[model samples]
Target: MPSKKPELLVPLNGWKTLHNSSTVLDSADAFYFGLQTNFSMRARADNFPIKDLLKLIEMVHDRGKKCYLTTNILIYNTEMVELYQTIQLAHESGVDAIICHDLAAILIAKEVGIPFHVSTQANISNLLSAKFYQELGADRLILARELDLNDIKEIASKLDIPIETFVHGAMCTAVSGRCYLSAELMDFNPDFSANRGKCVQPCRRNYTLEFTGEENEKIDFEPYSGMFFNAKDLCMIGHISELIEAGISSFKVEGRMRDPEYIETTAKCYREAIDSYFNGTYSQKRVDEWLSRLSKVFNRGFHLGFYFSKPGSDDIERTIRGNQAKLRKIQIGKVTNYYPAASAVEVQLFQNHLEIGDTIIFENKNGFYHKQQVKSLQIEGESITNTKKMSTTQPIIVGIKVSKKIPNTAVIYKFIKKTTSKMKKKID
Candidate 1:
């Protein structure tokens, strides 16, 4: 058993960069920001410009993390040449690599002399497909999500190329990269194989089955349905050892549509697990702790998925409601401008009331929560008797003595909003 640790790859969509920077910066070893060309038929433009894509790449790189630009959509028309040019620009802008499912785009990437990764949409499910991609100059292969653990191990043993597997996130019931759910149901096409970037995910929608009488003809089903076919998210946090021993090179987290906090927390958990495994101290308890943090986000229920085998009825969840997706707390103040001579921190409050000796917490979008106690109050560069009188917009200084360093962006709040009554009541 060769004991090399696998790399952690986090996928970032355009929307993930907005609120998840704090999280993304802290969690991912590297990131793949997705789909610059419009994949949604409903989108007005043909493509998101390379300039916009570069800004995101720069943002991710600024955080000292590696970034890969995705041009992985199926191409259908010549206009997609513009999309190819955008990938070229991403190469020039110094992205770590380009991800593409279309062979034409892969050739373009090679022509541009940039590194490339084969997208799962390429549907590399077997050793032969993996070898073909590796021979094509692909640096990594995102294995098709449909493969079982046995299949993965078999391929791993047969191939020398680096293999990346989806360790956590949603699973598509459709054949890998072959979904027409969007085009059929939403009337929008993803345009990848057709060489377009737009996609409408009709598969995630709900549908009711209808049966007709008199010769067993089918009748009209319900107009609206819930997520009947969507599988629970693939969560392998508890199975780190199995994956590490499978000879996989990278573990991927999928959430191009998720917020940054979700990206950061999930990435961090896997990173820790992989490192722990390689360091010879991997513990199930630690893995479970990391998974519990992930459960706090908005997600479908968790399952082992096809990694174990075909998902059973018990593996799918129709409804997914957890983790209040909104920010429930605000940073009231930070312990700043502390003086060793004065023995107090000049705290600034953003929106909450606090008193001397009151306990306060600071949390970021990544869900890194810490607490500090108020030792004294200060305002207008002077010690004040009443700190609670400060307005919502005002930054009131508070004096606090604590062991941990208070982060500047740390939101100081007295309470985290009770997103779940059961959890909150239990805590209470």
Candidate 2:
């Protein structure tokens, strides 16, 4: 392991992700989030409003964790006024640091008196490039995604500031995510620039080919036969020990548009892995378990990225078309009533049925999330084994005993393993 424990920097999109990620995983040392502005990379996400920065910062600080606001998008003269205001607000609201890509943002952060971490978009692939940013007063360097373990070690050893790198989530097929395919393909949309953070991922879509021979013979190709540009999602969990020992200062997860359950599971599993490494309990068996848990969440299959060597054809997940997630949260219904003293909730069925021994989670608009296994199911005053899956027009209310109180507005979802048995049925 490194001389100091590395920070697990999780992504935060909104209050819901923050509530789940912070509470479910104590291994999460800090959170990086984007605001509802074009200056952020995740403009399509449920980003927090600038007005709520103080409240968001306060919530994170109450849990004794640091917060980093992302102002890491390419800027233009039209966005200059808003960019300055955003950085100034971040500094005033006690954001620990601002993640920046453009030199203008770095200068603005310095002007606003906020610590800044150079974004991966800056493409600091070598020692000199890293040193260039460090000399410019960067508090940390989010190294280029193309670097290997050896390159990271060298930079981390020489740099006085912390070194951060992506440990999990989506990987861009381009070099350090500097591709213009999205911008070129989506030319009609003014905000489709990947540098501006509104990427319309045409690369991920399956493509087909057509050919015309010299004899004027036309040929058609099958759909999904060409996914040449699709890159597998990056997964470093199995190599967490190597990463911790690489002299890096922080490990960051790269999904800002993921669901709360996705955030919770990733944070919890990574925390377990990190803690196990330092506590002398890390092993192949534990790593296998963590890998299995991670596989249950949303992913496009996993690869070791460039940490080991250059990615080849095998690194591309060709078999799977889209999400390779094994687990799916099926909405059961919404909580219509709650009995606080008895620690029970009354749910009105909307889509699926619920039964004893089923795993369920309750979520509300205010970012409250509570998960529990159904120990008992009651209908009115009678106990039942299971309810039909929305069999009738009448509302079916089921009472479930919860460990804690849940809000009436909380929607219930059942975590179920995805099955391919229903795939052919839909097509047929």
Candidate 3:
């Protein structure tokens, strides 16, 4: 029931993101990433080096996808010159658009003659602000995360430009992520501010309530100890139809600081959801399956976020402190060699043991990933059922039958499944 199919905008953290999303999944319609510089959000992430900008852009373009460079950080007066250079370099490297919020960054993008997408940091929650950005030549508007589906529809109905919104990922406790808590905690350190993209997430910590009496005595309340401000991750897999019908131009998935495996699962799951919606295969059963798959990846549990209405106490992630993923991956070995004709790879074990019927993932440094169940394992080309844990000094080598070619630089990780009856105390 959408006017048109929306774009699946994904995040790029590093080389793994490039390989997994582009090669392993091939799902993203566009990718948004930050550079090594601090002008963009997710400054703590393993951002791409500026020297690789041209090559990275070429890689995405070769696959017929667009690249949007992120320069959405709050700019100080001293950083204007460097910001201009960054936007200029993005323009030179054939970037599709520069995602930014600061007026200086917006002006610089315009000066450098490049398209710009207003970031959610702009907080364009209403029609007036949406039209303002549209008039300012914003190719796309990433509306505030605080807006509900009705508000989104109302604004999208009046806007001519494409309107983008967060369909999934971490929901900041603050309005549109304009938080000073991290900065205040760091004693006004600009490098640690949420607006500067390096939030330490003090809000996610379990805090207790303390009371001071007239005698200067302190009392602690044990019942109030909880992660009150830790917002549950946004998941719209079940509501893809509603989101599409809201006239959103793009569905953005947050998590630039997450691992590559997280990126792969999220991108693939959302991609399937969106495609299924358009292909007339969207169903509650499929949604359930997608939710199960999503729960296996990195998340702080799931919620509908502000799409339906204001979040209440039920929306807050009160118990789990870290990831609530149902599965954990452990690196066990690396591919030492690949046999194309035999469809096999020589693996050198570094740690844990591997056996038949085990689920494993092959990750390449050059940007390729594959997951398969270990149906075939061999030692010196002879059939084997399992192998012992290899030592670091005298590592054990074995042959694995792969479905496709795996690079020599590819690392292997075994998936450790968990039960739903009880949650693990340590999540890793």
Candidate 4:
């Protein structure tokens, strides 16, 4: 009998990600999204407006993929009514499940008859806690990042509920991303609460390490020698088989605030790796290819985090705090007009072009995104053959028509195709 393929649960930061990025939708088995409320973990992201969430859920269901709504914020009594309402709305919208951290969220999920997946923020690290959540009607538990593979296997063996582990993306310096650094660093502002989805991310800043034995005197230390707060990003692309063999039911990629390119690249890499393993064609060369793709997006650095054993000094990245600008991809153009009847948006080029047979993403400020190829183009009502490159300092404007209409507020991005280190096709 064949083993069950572990589900790929991905993050959709906002409406743009949900609308654009076909690569993510095509490869991912399930998706998790945040709403524009204190109930979400990423309040800073362009989270889904309540009005659009219903439409998003319907679209996700229509695509035959599971959708998980995120209400993982730290809940208080004042927010309980809002939380219940959100869960009720989610249930009505056909959200397959809801991932949450607080016990209030669990109770609400249970009350609403929505399957609850325990968030990693709850920090389940042992068999006892795993069993407790399972008994509380938890459908799955996203294990804490601190757990080693052996620890995960032990919990998986002891529990009936599924064990989900993060396979890619950034790691928090604090345990389970529940750091109080932001709240403490800032002057105790209520809105800066990390659990409430407004983390200032003081940890992701340059910190000057200092040691002072006496309070009256200032000790001299290297001025901002390195970003000690920054930990290296996690990449398990090379070790997908090890994770799968360890009995993990799901592998998650962390980055709701990240761009569609990151989502697409990570999804394709992992999908290829997992499929290759199941197809009996897994190879080190294939792993290298996936790794190459993973590096092309936003990441500080990549290393396997605490999976085999405890992470050593090699795993911590003190050189920088924010994502490393390596293997970088970014916005190249913006939409200046929308022709809905013709299914096109007028694009303004800043740095790149929309050429024939080239993939482009239309990310709307009005809360929608979609991927399309440049099939046709027009300049001042004149037909032009493909590519439109900007040679001057001013933005170049042109009409673009595709399979779908793009909003006027949307900005278009051309996928920066690199010619370096071309990957060979896999042999089955």
- Compare the candidates by lDDT and give the number of the best one: 3
Q: In model 4, which range of ten residues has the least summed lDDT? A: 419-428
lDDT of each: 0.67, 0.85, 0.87, 0.81
RMSD of each: 7.2, 3.1, 3.5, 5.9
Better of 2 and 4 by lDDT: 2
> What digit string (tens of lDDT, one per residue) describes model 3 on residues 327-347?
878788888999999899898
Candidate 3 lDDT (Cα, 0 to 1):
0.87
Clashing residue pairs, backbone N/CA/C < 3 A, model 4: 19-369, 20-369
Cα lDDT of model 2 by residue, 1-428, tens digit: 45567899998868777544436436599999999888888888889977899998888888888999999988988888999999998999999999999989999999889999999999999999999999999999999999999999999999899999999999999889887989888764658988888898777766665544444335444334567777989999889889988888899998998887778888888888888889889999998998899888888889999999999998876545667778778777889999988788888887767888988888887767777789999988899989887743766988889987788889998877788652112211
Stretches of candidate 3 off by over 4 Å are 21-25, 214-223, 334-352, 362-375, 388-396, 401-411, 419-428
Residue 338, model 4: lDDT of 78
Model 1 TM-score is 0.71
State the lDDT at 161 in candidate 4.
Answer: 84
lDDT of 1 by residue, 242-352 (tens): 887877788888776665456666877888887787777778778778877787664567889788878887875544433333234345655455456655445666665
Model 4 lDDT tens row, 347-378: 77878665677777777566677776778888
Stretches of candidate 4 off by over 4 Å are 214-224, 325-333, 337-346, 350-359, 372-401, 415-428
Better of 1 and 3 by lDDT: 3
lDDT of 4 at 153: 85
The whole-model C-alpha lDDT of candidate 2 against the native structure comes to 0.85
- Per-candidate TM equals 0.71, 0.91, 0.89, 0.86
